[model samples]
Target chain A: MKKSLFIAAVAAALLMSGCSQKKPEVDMTKQETTETTAPAATEVDTGVNSVVGTEESAGEITTLPEDERMAKIKELEASAKKIYFDFDKYNIRPDQEPRVDEDAQLFASDAAKDLTIKIEGNCDEWGTDEYNYALGLRRAKTVRDALAIKGIEESRMVMVSYGESNPVCTEHTRECWAKNRRVEFELLP
Target chain B: MRFFLILFMGVALFASDATLEIVKSTDNRPSVAIQDASEFGNIRIRQKFFRLVMGDLKVTAHFKVDDRYRESDYDAMIDPLLKDKDYLFRYRFREDGEQRLYLDAKVLDLSSGSPVFERSYRVANRARYPFLIHRAVIDFNDYLQMPSVEWMRRYVVFSQYGKPKSADIIVADYTLTYRKKIISGGLNIFPKWADKNQRGIYYTKLGNRPVLYYYNIYTGEERRVITSDGMLVCSDVSRDGKKLLLTMAPDGQPDIYRYDIETGKRERLTFYSGIDVSAQFTGSERKIVFVSDRLGYPNIFVKRVGDRAVQQLVYHGKNNNACSVHGKYVIYTSRESDNAFSSNTFNLYLVSTESDYIRRLTASGINQFPKFSPDGESVIYIKHYASQSALGIIRLNYNEGFLFPLKGHKIQSIDW
Candidate 1:
């Protein structure tokens, strides 16, 4: 009886939520139903939503009309230095902290403050996908946290970890791996 | 379902035109010749079976498979006393009136002209012809008494990067000839088998955070397991399947944690502020092996479950990271040099926990993620070099390796 009631509540919530909405939750009953059906549902839902929210913000960068976004990408390209981390380390190298500061101040400006910036974290080819991802995200988060400290609103920034999937250098040299281990900034409309 | 129907139809249509090049045997291995004389229900059906048999023998590394026999060699093969060959293997394929396929295989003593070992398998589904070779190889291994190739029959679950910033987890045979994409359409990565039976897998999905999800392939049921703020992965599942070794960064520094799957209780395993990820159970599940940057570079490390003591496992490579364990044997990918150019040469090495004996598995190119076949006789890994990405298999005792290119997908991780 309870399972059927929960299922009905979920179906009703799905009907009410429509295709896309701004609210994170549909109904209180829906939460109970989701939890009853999936004990781990709430956490993952929060996770998915947080990513979706960040992506939605990231998508806003692309929405600034094509002309504006392309112009912005061109303008930001010179300012956005790919933040490099020491091998297996995400701590913003003492000398490179200024790069984060300069970019953060520019993104915080009134002209681009509302726009979303995607910080893509990457690793060298050495680590596994699982660890590289963690390392990559930590690197992105380090950049994100530094931007936040530099007064760029946290919501204005998005973190994406490509791990070692996307490599800037195809070579096998330590210099190439060092180049691959970086956080790249991308403007999303 | 619709996508699979199209993919399988495409594969079957393409199967006739595609043929894997037969691998030559490495040095000092026994030269075994598999003679072809199988009569099945259909010519096409028999040819497919023959192809799978060749693939099986080529993968096993125990025999130096000699398939390029001359016309004289074929005439010599029929005598069951083929000279200059260490062993002569023969097979006969028959179809019963009920459409059931039967495979009768025998290994002959070349000089004595006697069937030293024999096995027969009959199955109803000839359409699923891959199983015939799987059984044939297992039986062949049983006869040879080498490390059982039965692990080949199991599934290898992995995540591959798809286009446009998305990834999907897939289940395929060890050779990757048979593939079934279980998860797709979003960013799903790091799939680890949840149990010994390979029925379900634990993977992470990105959202506001990375969340661990447990999915059963057969039942189409997915359960949420755990979630973390920065990163999350079920690196290893305990032998009993009751506990999971997870890497999570709730406090901003990624560390290892033990999550009791049943009780929902979590215990911190490593408190290092640096990075500690890729934890796998070793030494009877009481100890753990992981990759840590606590020493300023990613290297393999070991620690007991409840103990605080940490031990470095590899001394040769400064950047030894990805690894798999079967008993005391550990196969890991280690970077040979810190030079910027050698970054693509992440080679695989085999080491034992109790001893300092380490063996190099690959000589060149970028080889990483060495997963020990469940039988521990061979290691399967991802090899990336130039514009190509491949799945590599290395036979331990033979010092031989084989590479099969993945045409489109770039591999991420794998669990056997």
Candidate 2:
């Protein structure tokens, strides 16, 4: 059992590296990311053992389901913290550094290697739609860069901006707005 | 407090071949008395139509509406011009015991004691009765030879925020009297009319990838224009309806893009890292104007369609956005105070491309999403204060304003 776990872990790391190397350049203008570009990470099948094992063991060990895996993923997601920003600004606050660091640490660890970090950036009910969407994207990109600098692969990170669309709080008060201006860490397997 | 958006001349503007004149009212709006024949016996329908016509006349700013359901009616034969009224409009609905509404409208020149115009309109149905009132007002406005408020009958496409992460793109008349929900479900926003005929609209749906979709309201067909990584919006559609002015975040930042609807080709217009959004084609699409924060705060900026030279458009407000263009005129919303948390007091200002004839439209309470009427005689916008939303109209020639309430949902933005 220990040897099988070792082989599975090593094999997963190899697949992650394989996928990351083929990933397109980050700064390419989206117009050029045409039909020929590789499928996005979201389309990738996220079955853990399937991602780890070869063609032969992929069917056997991968099919041998572990009921605890989904619960474990949910547990980790529950602990995943959110990073907040100031009004009309996308810069991650200094006080949020530790929370970003924690997410980075989780993304970089072996247990979370196969996990895809979807950083949802948001804003309060202020700025224009296009501007807020840009701000939220900037915030998510800032968090992704922080995670990348802390040893997480960019391929394992996802950036989606909600702008002022999705709010965790409903009140119009400053406290509620601040709470709404945040980047939530969602882990997808 | 007045806002003077002094024009800057660092970069020369392309000389306009089209001449623009600020046509002021010839005289104070022709005072008019409206009388409704009470013998129709359908008091409810008559009053409803009566109020709609009176409100329409008041909004045109072309008349001092003397008929506010007053007890006494003005005599059309007498010189009402002496009584401070010029035109006398007496309308009577002739319902022939059949469940149909037909209005006989006649406008009498109170000065000459002569009938200027007379017409009878058959309402299509009860749903279209308001249009009958609008037609009467249009005839009255046109009889005066002033720019008609016929455009007021056009539909305004707007998106209003509802339940968390959801919005509905609604198409309503200028008065918000008639509304139809065109798109709903999930974060769809930034609905811009693709044509002057109000056939289709372009909006963005927030998903894993933000996509701009062109939906034909009549045909019920939808086509994806483009899928952007961060955000995308169709801000303005060109006169010919073949091209689109879009705000897209393609290179990790939001910038303006001109898209050819037929060819499916997009030309990146602005290459700014901070933000460039809400772009519109001005003066025949040769000059593109947009909002940018490159100077560290939101301000209006303009550049020619193919020229690389970016010129400062407005120099008064820190956050001047929500702009609309009609010919040489540009109307925008400017923040009044310096409180970043204070998003409550943005006002609308109108300026021309050739010169800075800055006209302040509103005094207070977040007057935003200003779109000019097709004739450029009136401006329609959203009035937001406290939790209430209202549709506001600025009769440019009259320098007067009127508002109608939009209850239940908060308006996000509007386009006509």
Candidate 3:
């Protein structure tokens, strides 16, 4: 049982390493250029990584120009939207799968190949701020792992929990609370 | 003895109509005269006292002050303008060590050349200067037949962030003066006054086993209020202090619950398939206002406290998250955008329960955790800026705004 547990842990670590390997490839290309050129390239690469992670995870990848990349980013953003939770629950429900799928696809796209994305987890105004923050992180991590499983690079994903501070809906309604429990994606360039 | 007799005689002469009559009232604002008596003692002490009093009165929105008194004006001839009876309010320091400060003021009717209201207040050096002045202003306003000054006595509770995961719950006067740390030693946030008297606070202390804790401010006593698997927060307390409307995710889904404080029993208030949080009681405890994403986006909803039946309150905004309810007034925070990447500015808004008279309170910054004053005439909210957060005040009746910047400290949440 111990040996099998070790083997399973190793396999999980290997999978994470395999997903994170995409980071060095993009970083190496940017470093090969001049200093000023390198920083801009690194930023662009990071942006692309975020775009790719989101796009490919959702199964949409197409190489395009700058304007089209932005347009696609906007489109993917609109498609990804936000996933709402049931009152008090941080776990994403089955009904929110389509929204998460869209977000994962956006992360998986070629245009997002080198971009880094931060998953911000949030909660409704029900619990303590610290617990909500941790809960938010859990929800964000759940989304982050889902994207990783969808082939988005793990190293390109960062997570932060705002807890109950950044509620998109301020009303006291189940509908509002559901909208508030969410993992939102921010592309870092 | 002679002074007492003269004062008694004066009082008897005008006791029938002693309340200051509004001979000529104006939204034009009341002009006030503040005298500097700093030379009687230590200069620093007098200057601090002067500044505190001026700041308090200025923020009231009822006073228009003339700060023409200079350092040389201390021992120099008292300006003729200082004696102008349109409205005269004077404060002086007495030599008695028992009382560090003494304020004597009289609002005189210029036409009659007689003092309409006169009173003397004394305070010790150890006591909060702002509190003394706040009480004085309340007296002044009351004597002027303005309105009630009950908010002056209410305790202001706020969370001050000291370090990462280290914050303290502080109780202070509304002006951010007279602060005392009630709870410290961990990540404590969302410090809400549990009772109407502001004796205890409900806050979440973050650790391995994060739970909601109720702390008594005066007694230094505390107890864990509730524990939840994911999150637990005491959002609002009922008027009679019998029930607490809490947001808890006991089953791993955030939902609103009504917890009876006396019995320590809770009844699930909301059962949304999606997130239902940020609950507040409204309309005689039979109704509840809460936020839900059942519509795929956060919006306001109202429902009967016991029944499953729900009604939507706000439709224009996609994200309307936090709210405070008092009488027919429902004050809530609304986000401007649905896009996560967009600059989502959260602003405080007020709407009547009977009608759709929506009035936006704040315009520019991210304002949240709006708690109505017990009197329901004002609101205190947390304002997040670029680098820091502020404990801000909004006087609903006066339509005025004042922000006390959280200097040398960061704010997590505020309840007054």
Candidate 4:
């Protein structure tokens, strides 16, 4: 009886090994699902709003027809000048502080009182992706803190760092790279 | 009785020599030549597979791979041209309709004129054919009793920018030959494999709040992990897949944080006023190695999980911005230029955490995201030079390197 049991265990182990040799069914099933879903995902992507304003902006922006408010926000955003930064430096440059002051005034105006401000920070295509992102955030934070000091409510502002991915200029020249490292403001009503 | 004898020999061989034995016959490396034995298939795909297999064998650095393509019978006598080679690799490729692919491969000993290794691989999707080649080469190397080349079979996940405000996350084989877009649409960067099995990944969707998400590759399920203001990234995962090292900037200050996936609890690891990001788990998950600008410039630093003290890890570079850890070693990319704008060189360097040993791994170009293979025997990184991007692989034991160019798009970040 002991010998017979030993033989049966060895046979079962061999069968298990043979079954393991075949590729797992999970991969095939997953591959088919990805193939069918990837194109649908791409079709539904629909630019930047697919990720960001999906939840909050739905009930507010779609229902409202305030053309005057929209025009006011657009004008405020256009009037808010871009704040520049030095090569790897995130501190407000001496020359760029005036731009920040102008932005602060535009954001603090009566026309923009009911709106929230989004500070979009950008950088040149240098440094590691993670580091550039952090640096960009610092630039945005500096601008946010400066605006807050100028009486813009801290809770009404949001910051997003594009990190070298959203470069305005794709040139490899020094002048063009300098043009890419700046922060722009967007007003959301 | 036979099984006991085999087990005893295996244990004795491993216990006698703890160090890996890199395959070398006497003082010279073995030579290998490949022959195509496909009965019928797409001509373009066959040629591509031949080139890819040759590249894989050459990158192993354990064999002198013949570059010349030749067609011959899979089981016939070796040709006169390949008579001097040590081994002959034969493969048969077949495709059904459009998607399914099958590969049957054999390795024959030149002197003995007999089959030494044989295996077959198939994939349901034709776009994933590169993995078949990777697996075949890895299996052939293992049959020769050489050092493990199993890292060749891993999937490299990366994010690439498409437009100004658009990026897509993709998964590819180690060679970047087979690519599948896993995540598309708005600003999806910083992809990290959430588990060792490659079943799920964690990435941040750059939006107003910059939400971090965990995506299951098989089930097409995405679970919201967390969200933060300013910046958020899932940098590394623990060996057990229960904890994640994340870089989150809730108050506009990027700091490293350790998050427990099971409990949804977070523990801030760094309290630096300056930039701190890209934290990687090192030495028992009790410690982490990350990048920080607390010393006036970006450099690599390490800190314990519960300790308040931080220690500088790499003292050689001023702009050591990115790092990856394996065992007792850490590999990082250091900027080698005074000017941060325009084009500059970023090279990779290796340093031991326990000793003062340091080694420069790359000579030139922009090298970043140096990821060590699971076995710690190799590293795969991104290399951008002369307006082209390539996937760089380094064999640490052999001190050899290879580059496989990726056309068209630029790779933002990569993890295997």
DockQ of each: 0.24, 0.27, 0.03, 0.47
Query: Tens digits of per-residue lDDT for model 3 on B211-308?
Result: 88888877879898887754567778887878888877643467888999889999998887566776788888888887777886667789998798
Question: What tens digits encode model 2's per-residue C-alpha lDDT throughout B157-185?
Answer: 88888887788998877787777898988
Per-residue lDDT of candidate 1, residues A1-189 (tens digit)? 999997786766665455335333555467667775653333324324423123435443444477876787668755777889997778899888888888877787766666778778889866765678878988988988888887887776667677887787867677898898899887765
Choose 3 or 4, whichever is better by TM-score.
Answer: 4
Rank candidates by TM-score, best first.
4, 2, 1, 3
Q: Model 4 chain B: which ten-residue window has the lowest total lDDT? A: B16-25
Task: Give the alpha carbon lDDT tens digit for every residue of B67-115 in model 4.
Answer: 9988887677777767799999999887778668888999988888788
Cα misplacement distance, residue B78 of candidate 3 (Å): 6.3
- Could you tell me how far off, in angstroms, the CA of residue B191 lies in candidate 3 after the best superposition? 1.9
- In candidate 4, the residue pairs with backbone N, CA or C atoms under 3 Å apart (3 or more residues apart, or in different chains) clash, namely none
The most accurate candidate by DockQ is 4
lDDT to native, each model: 0.76, 0.77, 0.69, 0.85
How far residue B266's Cα lies from its native spot in candidate 2, in Å, is 1.8
Task: Candidate 1: list runs displaced more than 4 Å.
Answer: A1-98, A110-119, A124-126, A152-160, A166-180, A184-189, B1-31, B38-52, B58-64, B69-77, B80-86, B92-129, B144-147, B340-344, B385-390, B397-406
The best candidate in terms of TM-score = 4
Candidate 2: regions farther than 4 A off: A1-74, B1-27, B37-49, B71-84, B92-104, B109-116, B340-344
In candidate 2 chain A, where is summed lDDT lowest over 10 consecutive residues? A41-50
lDDT against true structure, model 1:
0.76
